[model samples]
Target: MPNTQSRLQVRVIDIHGHRGARGLFPENTLEGYAYALSTGIRTLELDIQLTADDILVATHDFTLSTAQTRNSEGQWLTGTGPESITLTAAELKSYDIGGLKAGSPYGAKFPDQAFLDGVTIPTLEEIMVFCSDYETSSGAGSITLNIEVKSDPTRPGHTDRAEKTVDILLALIEKHAYADKVIIQSFDWAILDFVQDKASHLKRSYLTIAAHNGEHATIYKGSPWLGRTQCLSDDETIPALIKKAGGNNWSSLYKDLDEQAVSEARALGIGLYVWTVNETEDIDRMIDLGVDAIISDYPSRVQRRLMAHQMHWLGDC
Candidate 1:
């Protein structure tokens, strides 16, 4: 475990509310985002996917999950729903995603989430504007948006090409003048590579999930997810790859991180942000690891943990 002094030696650990405090509110909705901001979390982490009309919306899944979505008639989807790209923005918004269905296995995961009706999907632009509006209305601190592009290399047909997705997202970021306030990320390294090539001014987080449930990891050599530029050596660490690829940050699965990886990232000057750390023990472990940021479905839990260590998410706020 790192002492408080050693912890502060690294960098202030940013607490990014994953999908806007998914444990406390519905995931990826404006309502949830508002709750997260109220907890004093400046970094808001959400995912984006394209609609049939080419509008980018803040959503986690490429397809609708039966767990939270309700059709216009107020019925829960029996199974998986259509790809987000198949629905027009207005068509998608007709469904309600304000709350999880009762007695659902997925709903069981977020037992404490507050249920709110009539909440529809918000566009990426809408979310940004909402945050700005919130600041203006409340005179609160500024927000740092961590936007993840929902592009999967394994399922290339699941969404549009990485280039097109990057272009659309970059345009919105530029249009909103949020280029400096956002960190663009994707599991598809091709997306990050495209951002690096064209929008180098934007910060990019290389999101990597190591092998789980017998699935292949994205960091391995020759993985299509790594894009055209990655011809990596077999033993290349993920942090090293981030450095070589000119990434501003590396957002990784919290379980896969260890002290060695932390040290390597620090030595190489790469920012480390771990995702979805919810349990108190896991949160404490991440805190002790001296990571640059912790993305969690429970931002308040992380905030408490940081304060217990005589630390916090934002300084002078």
Candidate 2:
């Protein structure tokens, strides 16, 4: 960790644009990223999925989602995800993601979200090139890429073999020559281990959930992983599990953390990075928690909040 400062002065920071600023724009689309950078945010958070042609594309869900996606046949994907077994990038591009599930108060939130026809899914390589070119042109604040490898053990062989997933993803990241400006993170610790072995220099951040992101969700009634539903388990109270999985950075849920939790993570040699923090109060509370980084859907707000804090490096004189 960097030296502790009495005044908050972090020249470099980790404020990730969750799903390219999902709250402001359509989630996971290139337009969202463009908007995020416009807000003075320095980094983007993205998700990856493997196509049938072994290409890695930027996506949130394994299949299409009603929130931001439609099917290849001009219809909404309201059914089982298992049916989308063989969607190639080209094939998946036929649908209109921006058209679906509209007219509700949900769409009212972002009335300005642009809609484009025939906009296909962008491969990870494409996103990399976009970021690279943007950096070259803008030359403003340095931007970091937080690309999540959207793979899981439950599906087992749904996307690609572990080796193949790494190969395609690593190649895409290397293709744009963004090896340095990237932070590879994942829910699957197995993927993190594989990434660490492959590129030792690569920075790794692990995701925790209720039990994972140092949040209470692990003990919540909704979680299937709980030891006994309707009753919180003693295992849920253990902080070691989060420390062990967080590697060097503990990215936990926002509500489940306090100042002590932040200090505990630091004490365990695990720094802090909280995820998916969207609401205003949540953002404020997390800021007070003094995490190393906080991933939020609204990076603009987080940036503004951080700028208001005191900076020791500037000097009080």
Candidate 3:
């Protein structure tokens, strides 16, 4: 265990509200973000999917999920809806995403999630602007956005080409003067590589999942997710890969992390951030591990954890 002085040495935990506090409100909706901002979570983590017309919109899944999406007429989708890439921004947002289906498996996962009516998907720019305005009005100061660019090399048709997607996002980031406040992250290393090659000044976070029960893991050798330029050696750490790619930060599944990897990441000067750690015990363990950040669906729970250890997410600065 870390001593009191060592624990106090941590200035801040850097709590990022995952999908705008998914456990408390509708994921990735404006209302959800408002709730997260009200809770004093300065770092808002969100995902973006490209539309058919090349507009970037806020959403998680590749398909418009039957779990959370409803048609313009307020009827819940009977099955999975068409990919966002198949619809224009206006067509995509026509579906309501403010409430979960009554008996959806996804809805069951977030029992406490509050529902709102008539909420629509906001474009990435809208989300950014809303956050900026919120900061000014609430005096929350500079807010950090962890924008995840959702892409899959294997599923090429679901969205636009990675290069085009990256270009669109970069344009938006530059136009909004968000270069200083954004960390462009992606599970697809190709996207990160594109950002690194094009806008080297921007921060790039390499996202990884060593193992998940059903999700694909990108750390293995020859994984398409690592992009064309990167591949794992027989003996190499994920942090080493990120370092090689010129990334200063890495986000991984919280359960896949161990002490050795954490220490190695620190030694390499890589900021290790864990994602979606909602349980109190797991959050406490991450705090003990001394991660650079904790991405959680329950920002308040994470805040309480920080307080329990006499620490703060905003630090003492």
Q: Highest TM-score among the candidates is held by which one?
A: 3
| TM-score of each model, in listed order | 0.93, 0.80, 0.94
Q: How accurate is candidate 1 locally (lDDT)?
A: 0.86
Clashing pairs in 3: none
Best candidate according to lDDT: 3
Candidate 2 residue lDDT tens string, 186-239: 766567667766875777776656545444333333443321223244454324
Report how far residue 85 has shifted in candidate 3, in Å.
1.2
lDDT of 3 by residue, 146-245 (tens): 9999997788573347889999999999898899999989999889889999999998888998844235677876778877556646356788888887
Q: What is the lDDT of residue 316 in candidate 2?
A: 23
Which lDDT tens digits does candidate 1 get at residues 1-317? 24535534534679999999999899899999999998789999999988778889988888898889999989998867888877899998999998998999889999999998999999999999999898888877788999998887777564356678788888988888898799998888888888999989988999987655136577776777776657466567888788878887999999889999989899988988999899999999998898889999999999888877778687552
Candidate 1, position 64, lDDT = 91
lDDT of each: 0.86, 0.65, 0.86
What stretches of model 2 exceed 4 Å from their correct place? 1-13, 71-74, 81-85, 103-117, 156-160, 212-239, 242-246, 310-317
User: What's the TM for model 2?
Assistant: 0.80
**Model 1 CA lDDT for position 178:** 93
